[model samples]
Target: MSMLVFFFVPAVIFLTVVAPIWLILHYWTRSRQNKGLSDEERQTLEDALSVAERLEKRVATLETILDAEHPNWRTAREDDYRRGGS
Candidate 1:
């Protein structure tokens, strides 16, 4: 029983003290490592932004062309919607 107490006390102390700190530190560093965007992720974000900008400009250009070609296109589209026309 004395030998068991000797080993058990240290094991209990380690579990109560060291184990939690170790777990917290392990997860903290892992989270910190993943906190920032990687270079490839940054490049992908830039590419997505560029494509979005181009698509936005294309939409504006298309709207302008539609305005010139059919001045009442917006109203016509709304009317079509109201009438449930596909």
Candidate 2:
């Protein structure tokens, strides 16, 4: 009756406040424990990044020359506008 509801109300309120905090900490610890990458994996990532950096440098040099020659060449916004109306 009223006594039962009073006890149940506090229990529900306590659970509402505490459940999310408990679950968040639980998942955070689990993710840190589970998602560790090995040293070899990190080395592979560094190698891939180096290759990407070299390619980006080359593309940037080409873009600089293109920009100097034709400033408005192949702007994506202009291309999109042309395509949209046509």
Largest lDDT belongs to which candidate? Answer: 1
RMSD of 1: 1.0
Candidate 2 accuracy as TM-score? 0.45
**After superposition, candidate 1 runs with Cα above 4 Å error:** none
lDDT of 1 by residue, 3-51 (tens): 9999999999999999999999999999999999999999999999999
The TM-score values for the models, in the order shown, are 0.93, 0.45
Candidate 2's residue-wise lDDT over 32-64, tens digit each?
A: 987977899999999999999999999999999
lDDT, candidate 1, residue 14? 100
Q: Candidate 1 at residue 80, lDDT? A: 98
Model 2 backbone overlap count: 0
- The 10-residue segment of model 1 with minimum total lDDT is 77-86
